[model samples]
Target: MTHSLRLTHLVVRVAVVALLAITAIGATAALRAEAVVEQVPPGAARAMWVWDTSNPQAVVDLAVARGIGQLYAAVPPNVGSSPQLAQLTQLSTLARQKGLRIDALGGDPGWVDDPTWVVDNWLRPAIATHLFSGVHVDIEPYATPAWQTSRSTVVRKYLSTLDTLVKAAGTVPLEADIPFWLDEVPAGKSTLDREVMRRTKGVTVMAYRNTAAGPDGTIALSAKAVEAGTALGVPVRIGQETDDLGTDPVEVKQTFHGFTVAQMEVQLDQVVAADSSSPSFAGLAIHSAAGYAAMTP
Candidate 1:
């Protein structure tokens, strides 16, 4: 063969080799990006609820044993009846020892709209004494049609009160446990939406109902709750009930709620998997410590 022809053949080989190398590099980069995008693991964090004077230490210990890392203090009304201060202190001490975090410091839902009087009267005192990481105002304003139409007013007041309390506490997070329907409050309610997002540290959609949605039904409801929470720019904690959903004999021989702990975990997994892209998909919190402990998964 001519020397010139030989040189041309060598050049072609070099170009082909370079092209293959580029293709391999591009493929590797694409794989890395995909992995990053899907890095969120199912049920990466477990959360549970704790009520006043309920042996928070035992609850925390049980939670830590089951890979649960969050505890929300349930501060209900009839404040005189509940040992709010003592429970908070006990939980705080136990939480510190077990490497746990206080996810919330309020209770029994609907405190979100009970007027600023309650916050100033009850919440402020609790925060000053307990030093929890946040407050969980489980407000079900959707039950009130008046609040739904005039939601901005109720939302603003609730958020304002939270803002004041957070300012007093300093860096403390404010979270809310809300109903399933609030998921689609609509476009003009953007003010309400932004307020809900801004005032609280995070939003946990309470998706549980006693004798309510069946297993598949529960999972579908939770997915919608998470989707709505995402649009509002808030992290969602899905609340699952152990005593409800009947009893699942297939997963566990024992009969309880048709929804076993395993079923609840499946629902949670669905929510997390639905939006792996948004870290706003905070984590899953089972309703109460007792319920969580009874749950299989």
Candidate 2:
């Protein structure tokens, strides 16, 4: 072959290889982004709620046994008190030493009327302790009697309260617990799910269901919430109920009762299958430590 022809051939071959390499790299990056699931900070594989901080050792032991790396421990309304503050700090240190994240948990629909109190009394004190990694609020405005009479106004107030709390939290991450059906509840132009995701750092969806894949199950009901969170870049944790809520109305009772650990694991697997592709899929949270520990399987 002529020298010029040989040089041209070599150049063409090199260019083709480079093009193929670029295409491969692009494809890999796209796949990685698509499969990305947000890992909850402190690397919590499973999280459980703790309603009391009186016995920090007991709570930590139970959490360690169940592979729980996060605790949504309840903070007393008078959290600013010296005794309460000391207890929380000790609990936080113990949990952190075990590589667990502790988030201050507080909520009351009444707080909606005075969100400033929620921030000043609860959030600010929790942050001042410097023990909590984040704050988790379980304010269900719909539980109030006024919700039945004034749905729109109540929901708007709820959204406004969350907005204020988020701002008050400053650099500390704020997470809210929301019902899976929030998508069905309208709050002005947008649904509750959209507004909450837009305001909070993350959300724990109370996707209480016996199963995970059916029409009324956790995965199906949580679809809209996951989608909204994913779009807004907010992490979402699917929460399951393990507590036995006795003799409540059928609808209310559906939030808890009747689930073994094995069954819950199965349901969580389905949730992961359905949502693992989303960047907002954080992980799973059991309703409470005591209840979950009592369950069979």
Output the number of the TM-score-best candidate. 2
TM-score of each: 0.65, 0.80
Query: Runs in model 2 with CA error above 4 Å?
Result: 1-44, 247-258
List model 2 lDDT by residue over 1-297, tens digit each: 010100110000011212111111111221011111222223226678887566676677666545666789889865778576777788889998977788889899898889988888887887787778788899999988999999998988898999898888877888889998999988678888888888877888888876787788888888888898878778788888876676666554355456655566666767777776777777778887656655544
Cα TM-score of candidate 1: 0.65
lDDT accuracy of residue 275 in candidate 1: 50
Residue pairs in candidate 1 whose N, alpha carbon or C atoms collide under 3 angstroms:
109-138, 110-138, 110-139, 174-201, 245-258, 245-259, 246-257, 246-258, 247-257, 247-258
The worst-scoring run of ten residues by lDDT in candidate 2 lies at 1-10
Assess each prediction's global lDDT (C-alpha) against the native.
0.52, 0.71
lDDT of 2 at 225: 86
For residues 1-297, write the lDDT of model 1, one tens digit per residue. 010100110000011212111111112221110101112264346667665335665576555444566677665443444555566677778886876777444543254555565666666665665446666676555555657577666555556655665565555566666655554664244544345655566666656643223554444556665665567556766665554333454323211244544454455556556655554566666666544444332
Model 1 lDDT, residue 33, Cα: 8
